[model samples]
Target: MAEEDTARHRARMQRKKAVIEERIARASLERGVFLLHTGSGKGKSSAAFGVLARALGHGMNAVVVQFVKSRSDTGEEAFFRRHPAVRWYVMGEGFTWETQDPARDAAAARAAWETARAALTDPGVALVILDELTYAFKYHWLDLEEALAVFRARPFHQHLIVTGRAAPAALVEAADTVTEMGLVKHAFQAGVKAMPGIEW
Candidate 1:
């Protein structure tokens, strides 16, 4: 009975491998992708940063425009900014609750969007990461239509990664790959404080 079960498992694995290979052969599309990471999860920005690291590994020129984070002391920021190929901009005054002024937030978002626009249009930039950009759109700090237009007009070979929760429907529709990170549990809920390297 054990031998029979092993044979069956081997056959199942072979079938799965064949199916995967067929799909790989069928997929021939190759171009820069627009990726959106959304939903109520902690890894949205972290996942985007992983892609940034991959792009840099390939010697690609990249730009990161942070929309709603004021601090520049994060580990990823410090490390990526040291690379000559990256142009990093942290444009937000702070989080919404901390700023406590809608007008001020709007102005900051606008400024960040301007920088993002330039990055998107630059043909030399291979990758662009707009970190925490959903908050700007969710709060109506930036014009959605204007942002979409800029995205549509971006260079064909320029890849974009937009990360944050509550991504807009239009943005989702525009993205070639959309990943929604669902949260099942969190350390914060367990009263665990965020540690430096892990949280940052």
Candidate 2:
């Protein structure tokens, strides 16, 4: 009868809807891997921090290791440290240009890299952010090959985010997601000093 036909049509529609939902779920999965954000622009670190916030918001475990920037004078550092989902490690050494000592800078870079390596190996760490890592590699303080090996050896579900200016070509090739931010304008070009909370 007409009533029986209506019931069967509803059942069929429900099955179709279930199938569509399954497909969507499968496609939206995040395949954990390495992501490199680099360029001569101003937002590389900001973009990395955005990923950090997103990971923390989702109840995922994250570790942030700061390389060239270790001055604990930034608001982001203070805020993120208070978050329960994040483990923050700072090298406490400013930078190569600031220190003007290659040996000291190399030692600091190595210490930070050690922390980064440990985070990559930890199964509980879902996200690892290496802030300004490119500069360390550029300065030849961190071994490029060793760093790439760590990226390759991370847990199956672990993701990494490396941010800085002029990312090495080797890193760009290895990253699953590579973003290059081109510099259109910068206040530093006009002899204006870096502003607090904005550039720090």
Candidate 3:
């Protein structure tokens, strides 16, 4: 009976391999992708940073523009800053609640977009992380269509990542891959304060 089970598993593995190989073969075009990480869960920005780390391992150049995050003391920023290939910009004054000034937030976002726009047009930049960029559109700081046009016109092999809560529907429709992280539970809800390195 063990041998029979082993034979069945082998057959199933072979079938799966064949299917995967066929899909790989069919995907002939190679270009950079636009990824949207949205929803209420944590890790959206963390996931983008993880991808940036993976790309940096390949010796690729990248630019990171932080929109609603004004902190310069985050762990990822500190580590990635050491990498020569990364150009990081913290362009926010803080979260809306902290700033309490829409005009100030808009100005900050516009400045960040200017930095991001330059990177988007640069062929040398292989990856661009626009962290918390969705807030620009959410708060009417930037026009979505204008931003979409820039995304469409970006370098052919440039990968772009946008992370924030409540991503716009238009942005989701345009992204090559969209991952909405649903909140199951969070430590903060259980009275645990945001921890350094882990939560930051």
Candidate 4:
């Protein structure tokens, strides 16, 4: 009876492999994607950086523009900054609540957007990660229409990833791939503070 079950499982696996191969052969589209990662949960920016690492592994040039985080203590930022192909910019004055000045926050957002726009227009940049950029739009620090225009005008072969919570409806519609990280449970709720190499 066990031998019969094993044989059946082998047959099923073979059939699944054939179907997957057929689907792979049929897929011919090759183009850059606009990906958005957003939610109240964690790992949105971490996921974007994972893609950045993948691009770097493939010898592609990438740029990261941080909008609302001014700290330089992140492990990813520290590691990626050493690579010549990665252009990293942290343009935020700080979080909105920390800055407590609408005019100053808006100015920082505009400056970050300008840097991001340059990366988008550069043909050599294969991947552009706009870290926490949605906060700029959500807080009205940057114009949504202007941001969309830059995304639309980016090079045809350059991929863009935007990561933050409370992504705008327009951005969700514009993205080719959107992942919303839903909150289930968090360590912070249990009074566990964020640790390095995990939350950073």
Top-scoring candidate (lDDT):
3
lDDT for model 1 comes to 0.93
Off by over 4 Å in 4: none
Error of 4 at 75 (Å): 1.3
Please identify model 1 stretches exceeding 4 Å from their true place: none
Q: What shift in Å separates residue 56 of candidate 2 from its native position after superposition?
A: 1.0
Candidate 3 local Cα displacement, residue 19, angstroms: 1.0
lDDT of 3: 0.96
Worst 10 residues of 4 by lDDT: 90-99
Query: Who is ahead in lDDT, 2 or 3?
Result: 3
Clashes of 4: 0
Cα lDDT of all candidates, in order?
A: 0.93, 0.89, 0.96, 0.93
Better of 1 and 4 by TM-score: 1
Cα displacement (Å) at residue 106, model 1: 0.5
The 10-residue segment with the lowest total lDDT in model 1: 143-152
82-122: candidate 1 lDDT, tens digit per residue? 99999999999898899999999999999999999999999
lDDT of 3 by residue, 1-200 (tens): 69999999999999999999999999999899999999999899999999998999998999999999999999999999999999999999998999999999999999999999999999999999999999999999999999999999999999999999999999999999999999999999999999998987
Which portions of model 3 miss their true places by more than 4 Å?
none
lDDT of 2: 0.89
TM-score of each: 0.95, 0.83, 0.97, 0.92
For residue 93, model 4's alpha carbon misses the true position, in angstroms, by 2.0
Q: Is candidate 1 or candidate 2 better by TM-score?
A: 1
Q: What's the true lDDT of residue 179 in model 2? A: 92
Candidate 2's TM-score: 0.83
